[model samples]
Target chain A: MLVFHTALMRPPVIDNLQYAKFSPRIFEEMRAGGVDAVHVTVAYHESFREMVLNLEQWNRWFEDHPDLIFRGTCAEDVLRAQQSGRTAIFFGFQNPSPIEDDIGLVEICHQLGVRFMQLTYNNQSLLATGCYEAEDTGLTRMGREVVAEMNRVGMVVDMSHSAERSTLEAIEHSTRPIAITHANPAWWHEALRNKSDTVLRALTEAGGMLGFSIYPHHLRGGSACTLDAFCAMIGEAAQRYGARHLGLGSDLCQDQPDSVVEWMRVGRWTKRIDYGEGSAAAPGFPPMPTWFAGNRDFGVIRQGLLAQGLSEAEVDGLMGGNWHRFYAESFGPA
Target chain B: MLVFHTALMRPPVIDNLQYAKFSPRIFEEMRAGGVDAVHVTVAYHESFREMVLNLEQWNRWFEDHPDLIFRGTCAEDVLRAQQSGRTAIFFGFQNPSPIEDDIGLVEICHQLGVRFMQLTYNNQSLLATGCYEAEDTGLTRMGREVVAEMNRVGMVVDMSHSAERSTLEAIEHSTRPIAITHANPAWWHEALRNKSDTVLRALTEAGGMLGFSIYPHHLRGGSACTLDAFCAMIGEAAQRYGARHLGLGSDLCQDQPDSVVEWMRVGRWTKRIDYGEGSAAAPGFPPMPTWFAGNRDFGVIRQGLLAQGLSEAEVDGLMGGNWHRFYAESFGPA
Candidate 1:
């Protein structure tokens, strides 16, 4: 009875944290915070060959840090990580670059354990319009096929950095539920990267998941956002949209230097620096909110949500249970 | 006056022949045939880097056979070749493999002297559906952008191997004239690779070009097709669609080994042999019509067209004059 109770009590906590400044300390932090799984960004602007090199680096990390982390290719891996008291890391691409122009690579990427792939990343891509493109052309010819292939192979279609029309079309076109693995509601933050209420509503209605972002640029008050305010926003979101579709994707960039942010925003595609949602005068990583700074800070968010009047179950879901459920369903062949 | 008359008599001829088993013998035959220009294919299923190696090989050929051939990037190159008593070899692609998924590579291909590109070849591609696919999904989202980019960069959109809907859409979408670089009209042969009269009419009406194919698979009677029969079909095509849109594309696979034919038809897309528009039992290059066995046979076709009641000027246009005019107009930025 005690064994069963302990198993029930240790339900997996997952974060779809888009990108993190990777180091052994970060894995330590994840373990400290009880993070069972995280969908880590493996490709932002990488070509297929470059992405393979990244996979090599990650393989080394898994070998070197076996106690703190393991590569998660499916929901079972998350459960295993929880059982072992370690964090499971799943690969994801913020752009479709790693697949390039070939539809065959979609299956190859799934074989490589890329669990989530955003159709675009802050600029018009071969697949769809990015959030920053002047005009949205929606899902491109290649984009439609790639989405179908991704769906078939069980790679979750992520539209976290895509424009509204493209994201909406992806949702309509994809057979499986898509994800905006990291972003908040535009109504709450008014950031260009944030989703509109229409997108959020349609997304949840279509069985898709939305991972509420904690990036400073996407917050209501940048780095100064209060824990109470952030929890209140999630509470209101739960009221407007069902709590089942809500989860936290903290989007932590802990211990990262400035240049890494530049690479994340403008990889090889541009000779000029594109600060994205941030201004050029301050094109570095913005200061994370004091209330929620790293993996360890997820507890603070859970406590604040409970204080903000969310039920304990609802708080649990927001912290990671929702994502744990989504990961279970999304990370396999449809 | 006699010298001027001699110069006028040697009118330049061009063929969008795709890939001929390129050799010095073929170049000599081209000179014998009075063929001033040929759009030689640089890629079938090759990526950009592999295509670059092909360019390197062609460069070696040009350097070794300078008296016989020169590179052609514009219509003027044809006239220059005519004056120099050499054949002008213009680069083309039978498939969009060289560009891969990067739209930026379109301009790079043009800069490398690629003047023509087919959207697909015997299968569905990133850009459009090939004729062999069960369901033709027309111009893909990427296809539209690629066509626009091709137009802006002055690359002729060839729809020889693409499906009907995709071909029609490409013609409609492309601002400049597109081409059915090689294939007979369906009214002439009814081959799966042949264009329908509807496609032909739409193509010519939109100021697009059609190149009469001499490849046996695309001919009415295969290798047994007679010169008079072939010429008669062109005469009928001229009556229905204006003579201005007609030119020679030959679809010639001269002097190629059977394995090379397999490469052209199957590429790297499939591991299994795909006898495109040919019987699997005889999955090799079909015999060339006895009357049109090599590049040196163009004059026989010209004479046969004249015998079938086309005027000297119409015969001239059919042989190469039309393509020369098209080359002049279409090979520069729109």
Candidate 2:
């Protein structure tokens, strides 16, 4: 009974957001944390060729650490990772830069194992407006074409870092469910990047999943936020949008220096400086909450959720069961 | 008065096929021939980067001899070339290799000013089967997608080197008019490279154009073929498919070595030699007819067409006016 429970009862543990400075140490940490699969951002402000170079780097990592990590293409890969005692690294793009203005690249990115692509990062893109943009234009012509293509090719259209109108339009226009792969509700903590209740309501109503982000800027108390408080917020969100539409996407930029943050904030778009989410004084990666620091700390969130009076089935769904179902349905042609 | 008649009354003279050993002398010959435009092959079996390098070479040529030739994107460029006394050079690919397996590069190639692309060179491709294949599988799945993309982005689909079934399918599948940019009708000359009546009818019925080839192998009497014989065939073709659907594509290979023919026939697809159009006994370019030996010899074809009793307007259309109209319609979004 103990063996069956350990092997079969535990659900696939998936993290739908990560852009870590990946190394052997992270692979070991992922294994230690029982991570079945992780959606990792492999492109920020890179061209198609540059993004391909990044994929080459990941290919080298996969080859070097086959025992710890391998590439994930579908939901079954998550179950495979669990049975094989390894983690499946799924690729994504934080911005549409990799595709550059070509709608056809949407399918090519899907072919390259990229399961999620955010239409915008933090400003206006060829596709859609980002969260930091002052004016929100829903979806550009190319953005609508790309959304339809992403649906056809089974790539999830992620609006995590997009503006409100654009995100709402994406949810309405996409034939398949689009994801806000890593974002918190603005009701939980007011942040420019946090989504509003209207957007969240439309997202879940469209069968889309909203992965709760533990990024400090999105938390109510920044880096000082506790696991209990985080779990309590998740429980409340579950009530608002139902437990089936919720999952964890810890936007952990682990082991990255401050320079990486600058790249993420202002990727080749500007020259001087546009400090995003951070000011000139504190223009760096914010301190991660002590309770949920890195890949190894997911256990504390699971325990905190249990303490917050959520049923075991609901906890399991949040801990990755829901994502597993989504991956199965969303990673193939419509 | 004669100068104005020579300049304004004459329509644009275009050769939609030429893989010449392009040099300053060739550009000078293009000017000498009163050729307003020529669609030149820029890729055979090149990868995307290799094709870009080839484009870089063309850019250098364009910069070096702006007086002799300029790049053309649409139909008006032909008129512009006639006014400027310069030939308009348009680029095309004899094979889909430049796009490799990525459909996204279809739009990228259009962005780079490639106006035409063939689905196959002389072998099976990811898109469609070539003439040399024993079984013509018609358009593959990627072929359908690429045809739609090519139609959307204004890249003319040229099926000169493809099999009959594939050509017919492309004519049926494409929303826009496709082209047989070079090759004669099999009814006149029984060459494997020539189009059958079924394919030609479908193509022209769908508003496509057929640019007649003057290559010796595709002629009724090979190297000994006469200008009168060629013009008579054109007259017959006009009777069958209307004069507006016919044009000239010379299929000229002036000053090209036999080795270039080898590359075209066997572009890294195999290890063994595929003599293609030439066997072990005769593995070199057959002599071009004396009446049309070089680009400067368009006068003879005109005289022959007039002798064949085609009206001036019909002769004008066959010369280049038809292609100019096709270009105006084909090289932009449908």
DockQ of every candidate = 0.01, 0.02
Clashing pairs in 1: A141-B141, A141-B142
State which candidate has the highest TM-score: 2
Docking band of candidate 1: incorrect
TM-score of chain A of 1: 0.97
In order, the B-chain TM-scores come to 0.97, 0.97
User: What lDDT would each prediction earn against the true structure?
Assistant: 0.86, 0.89
Looking at model 1 chain A, report the run of 10 residues with the lowest lDDT sum: A1-10
Error of 1 at A164 (Å): 0.9
lDDT tens string, model 2, A1-334? 0122345547878899999899999999998898889999999999987787688687668757989999899888888888899999999999999888766667656756889999999888999999988999889999999898889779999999999999999999999998999999999899998999999999999999999998899899999998888899999999999999999999999999999999888778889777888899999999999887789887888899999999988998899988988998899978
Identify the leading candidate in terms of DockQ: 2
lDDT winner:
2
The parts of candidate 2 lying over 4 Å away from their true place are: A1-9, B1-334
Query: Can you tell me which runs of candidate 1 are displaced by over 4 Å?
Result: A1-7, B1-334
